[model samples]
Target: MLTTAPFTELAAQMTGRVVTASDSDWDAVRQAFNVTADLRPAAIALPRDVDDVVAAIAYARAHGLRVAPQATGHNAKPLGTLHDALLVDVRALQEVAVDPAARRVRVGGGVKWERVTPLLAEHGLAALHGSSPDVGVAGYSLGGGMGWLARKHGLQASSVTAIELVTADGRFARVDADHEPELFWALRGGNGNFGVVTAIEFAVYPVAQLYAGTLFFGLEQAGAVLCAWTALLPDLPDEMMTWIKLMRFPDIPDVPAEVRGQAFTIVFGAFLGDEEDGRALLATLHELGPAVDTFAMAPPGVLGDMAMDPNDPLPYLSATALLDELPDSGVEALVAAAGADSGSTLTMVELRHMGGALARRVPGAGARATLPGELGMFSLGVPLDEASAVTVQAELDVVSRAVAPHKVGDYPNFVEADTDARGFFDEDTWSRLRLVKALYDPSDVFRGNHPIPPADVRSL
Candidate 1:
């Protein structure tokens, strides 16, 4: 049997808070942002800094327990169970440092894009951050973060220069290209199967302004707008990036009266060059005569909020896939599944165009660099009741099957609960990840969000 005496003693020595099931706040401590995950971990440790993380790992090891590190818990659905493990809450480890001369920034495990983006903006520098500012930097980078500047800078993981982590053996180590080279490679895009990262350092870019905004049109014009946008995509420079979203806002007090219960098609984009040329390039989209237009020149700090992602926690189901092409047939399939006429109570349906810098794989960088397809397809369902849940799920299945022919696997960061881990990587890449998992986490002490099993367990 596992001993509790040592755990009690370890908790007494920690500078951070350690809560057990008996604690009044245990329910809140073990909760994830998605709300679907009702995790009941043996203990939840909120580490304030790097030392606290080290101590938590050591204590878990002594008691023969696993450690699962979580920052914002954005992608917690894939984390199977934590009954025999300690959930390391690193939200208090918020540290951010920027070196403008070297064009690099260092962030703590718990740091969010919201905090770092503004800090880097002071020096006219920008880090590759995901669409939402609330997303944790470490978790996002580990999963191959896709950002607004991705077309020019590439995935967030590609810019990583170093990682400081507490390994399964309770040892603190620094991994980089020149140090622990193999481990560094796995840590980049391999997810968090190796250890509890304390801090990560990556290069940033010198950017001050960008022409970005969203244009909205009624669902009646979706077909025409979608076709025009797709046709115009090829003519745009590598500095331009865009996506199309089909949304049906709910009729509620929280939603604006103007768009409440309204179904519309919106085109979102950002251009990296000067406003004049950017405007000229996007003039055609303007001619399409969207019902609403909000394009403007904005500071780098505003990029995080551009996508308009909800900051609060809620119950939802999401799925993601890469699309090789979006022909007329594909657009029809998309509209038929989640569009206004589909009768699906989905909150959002998006098709993000991918290519440019996102198409070129960085050599010896990580397991994944470039997307396997030309676009990313994401759908999210919001079910208010059991019947609604069933209805949305059925519709999601129809959407998946309809676009199955164009799918070419999925992006790791976009992967969700039901997706198989192997689908995120190719056969060779998955095999290499297994070996790396064996090397760093032989006993499988760290059970991260999307785990890569050890080599020995693959055959079984």
Candidate 2:
């Protein structure tokens, strides 16, 4: 049991809400966005501003408790019951400022993509954001954010110009390429293992709108469509990006009749240019005869909604891998594992194209600036019961094994819970990350998702 003395004093110093296990709202405060993360921290503290965050960190240290800073908890699957830590909730630190003339945006720790994208749209500018609008900006960008425009502009982490963070020693510091250069590099793609980021400033493009949407086809054509898709990757223009998704709908009554219990193959695409050019470039896909096509010219915000990601939280298991190449053989393996004929419990299998600008690593950029693979493959499994969970787990295992030969590394954001951080980077990059951790947070005060331990403490 955790003593209340330090918490009591901490509450007196904070101008924010502090919920303990004894509070009436403990159940709600302790739960993460993903239902699977039933975190039971000693206490949950909501920091309203930068000062409050510093106070919370100091109080945790004073009481021999670590501070696990989280904003929306969207990627909290790996964080189990945090009984030994104080969960610092940064949702109340919502602040956004845009320099339209400079083509940059400064976002708070709590701001979501939905909130920031529309704001930038007003100025005829846009930033790189994830598929879901509900995902927190700071957390997403910190893990190397990938979006529809990534092929042209590169990862979001590479665009970061500055970050305001409260270090483990309770000091507020501004990190940029010239200031705290190593820490700045680590913070951009370093998984937020060193400090609590209060705000971040990143570059945005002068794009107002683009042609984006999905082309849907019945599952029977999945094998042929996927093979063609793989063949087209090498010829795609830098201004465009595409991904293929194979989804199996459940037989639940709530599902629409058109897709209930049936599988569908979707070819979703986005291009950053004029409508006429976009259509002309995508004409080959139209010749393939999709059952339905929803592609059209729309605002950049529409990219977040194109995937139809769940707006609310639920229990699910997800895994991802980076592939050095997605040849015909790899596509065939993907189809056999989760396509029409496979009685799989997995809900979705997606292959996102990587390269173009992603292949060019910026000089003096962060650890994630370079693309490790040509494609990123992800799988999602939703289980409603113990038996269903077992089935989904089995299918996921089979899917992983099928693509094992093509696997290289993995994107930090898409990696599963309990996965070692070493796989996300090369040997030299991992060593550099460990050294940064040792210098900034030697005691490992913040062991958040995909943690990188201090260098000297490792078992060599």
Candidate 3:
């Protein structure tokens, strides 16, 4: 059995603080980015550096406890239970080093997109970061990050040059294409299943500015907007990417006054080109006469805030799927499920255009080299209470059913629930991932949001 006495000794060997249930700040220390997640771990270790991470892993192993490495916990809902696990919070490992000349960046596990995007913009460079700037760099890249530049540059995982982590055996190692190649592939998309990642180095692009913005239409135009957007997908070039969303903005102080308490069908996009070409590409969308048009030639930093993702934690339920296609019928079904008169209280129902660079596998790509789909559908609802939760879930189900016929596969990063990790890979890929798991973490000392068991254990 575990006790506070043993933890005291373990804490002495580390430079950072260790918080147990008895600590006064236990509630704060154990909290996840999703307020709905109820994480009750055996203990929480706040690591300050690589040595601290090694110390935490050693302590967990000696005490016969599993370790779960977490940063911002954006996907913590999938962690489920951690009764016998030590939650290694790596938020204190905030290190950012950018090489402007080389177009490279090395960041700590705790670093978020918000911390680096503006800085990269100053150097006329940008990383393949997602809509939400608050998302951690390590977790995002490991789980196959997709963003505004995704269709142009592919996934951020492919850009990863190296990963520095402490293995399950409490040994520090760096894996890349030249060293521990198989392990390197697994870590890119296998998430935290192998070890506690301390730092990651990746490549960035020399992009100072781009033509990007949004077009907002009344809720009544949802059906028309989606139909036009679907037709426009085939002609869009690799340098351009777009997403259409049905959003019902809440009436709150945090929300912009102009959009608060309003519902709209929004079309947002980013293009790695000049204004004339970008505007020509979106000429069809402009003909619809949107209520608001904010398109302009903006700096790369503006892409970070264009999505307007919530800055604070909120209780919400979400669903996602990779869609092969969204025909006219699918658009009609979607409008009937979540449009103006559908009676859906869901906060957002979005469909992101996929393909272009996202469809091709680069030379040194990792496990998640390419996502197989032309469109990615994501829907979510904010549930404030038990009654609201039920309504939100039912509406989400309806929206999901509408697009069920076109689903090709699922993106592991967007899958927010506990599920078989094998579903994310092919038979050959699954076998190799398990083999790598057996070689490095046979005991399964580390647990990721989507756990991948070793081959030996699966055979048993």
Candidate 4:
């Protein structure tokens, strides 16, 4: 059993509160965004500033405990069994500074995309943010962030100009291309293994408006819709990003009335071009005759909620894969596995178009400069009970098998479960990442969601 008595000194050293297992709000403090993730950390430090972060790291190190730096805990499921760790919750470090003139923004680690998207929209600027607006900017960027602009602008990590963090040694450091380039490269894609990130600065684009929205069809038409969508990808340009989702809308008050309690095969997209060209490009999908078409010109801010990801915590199991071009047979197999008649209770099965800028590595790029795949597939199911969990796991497995043949790799950001982080990169990149970890965090004091141990420690 853990006690607050040991944290008295640590609490006195910081302005933020230190939550222990003995505290009344321990359950609330230790909870992750994924309700299923039962995080039982030795203690949780809600750091209000960078100084408190440094103090938390020092305290954890002195007490022989590993430190896990987290903001929103979106992917906290991977940090399994945190009994020997101190979770430095940085949600209190909410800061947002946007310089529209320079096309740059610096946000505190705790800042979520929702907090910045609308502000940037007002200035006719946009960042490479993912589907959900609630995801923390720090965690999303630290992991390889992919979103609507990904096909044209590339991953959010590559756009990062600077990252400020408190390293394992309790020192504050700001790493950029010209300063600590090695660590900068690793932190962008390698995650928070070496330190606790306090803030991140990245470039935004001047996107005043674009043609974007969803095309909804009956779930029964999934196979036909998917086949047409795949065929249309070859003719699409980088400026046009699209995804097809087989979704079952829950009968909840939070969901829009029209989509509530309905299942549909939805084709959602954002095109950085005029409505005429966007409509021309999507003519094939339109010919299929969607039940409801919402295509129209909209500001970048609308893209944040376009995907309609759940904003609340829920128990769910997910599976993901990076896939090559899918043949007609592959499409049929996918439909057979998760379509309307598959008896699958999964909430969503989505395949996002990936290529163009997303597959090209530019000069001065970070460790995760490019992803390898023509499409990225992600699926999830909410398991309300033990029986439902087993059913969900089985359906997820079937969906995995459907795409297993064309599976190329996995995106670290989409990989929620704990696994070998090395698999996310090539041998050389993995080796270099380990070396950086050895140099900066030789004792392995920090624990990332996907932990990458030091080179020397790995050999042992």
By lDDT, who's the top model here?
4
Off by over 4 Å in 1: 1-7, 256-258, 457-460
| Cα lDDT of model 3 by residue, 410-432, tens digit | 99989888999999999888888
Which pairs in model 2 have colliding backbones? none
lDDT of each: 0.83, 0.84, 0.91, 0.93
Candidate 3 lDDT: 0.91
Relative to the unseen true structure, what is the C-alpha lDDT of residue 329 in candidate 2, on a scale of 0 to 100?
A: 85
- Per-residue lDDT of candidate 1, residues 250-293 (tens digit): 78777779888898898998888778888788788789899898
Q: What is the lDDT of residue 443 in candidate 1?
A: 88
Q: Candidate 4's error at 296, in angstroms?
A: 0.3
Q: Report how far off residue 453 is in candidate 2 (Å).
A: 1.0
Give lDDT: candidate 3, residue 348.
Answer: 96
* CA RMSD of all predictions: 2.1, 2.1, 1.4, 1.6
Q: Point out the higher-scoring one by TM-score: 1 or 3.
A: 3
Q: Candidate 2 lDDT, tens digit per residue, 1-460?
A: 3445637788889999888978988888776767877888889889999899999999888787878888888887776777788888899888999898988899888888888888877776778887789889988888899888889989999999999999999999998988999999998788769899999999999775588888888887888888888877788898888988898877877667877887889999898887788877777777789988888988776776677677677778777888888777877887788888887768888889988888888887897786678888889899888788888888988888778899887888987586788878888988999999999999888966888888995555
Clashes of each: 0, 0, 0, 0
Off by over 4 Å in 4: 1-5, 457-460
The residue ranges of model 3 lying beyond 4 angstroms of the native Cα positions read 1-6, 457-460
Ordered by lDDT, highest first, the candidates read 4, 3, 2, 1
State the weakest 10-residue window (summed lDDT) of model 2. Answer: 1-10
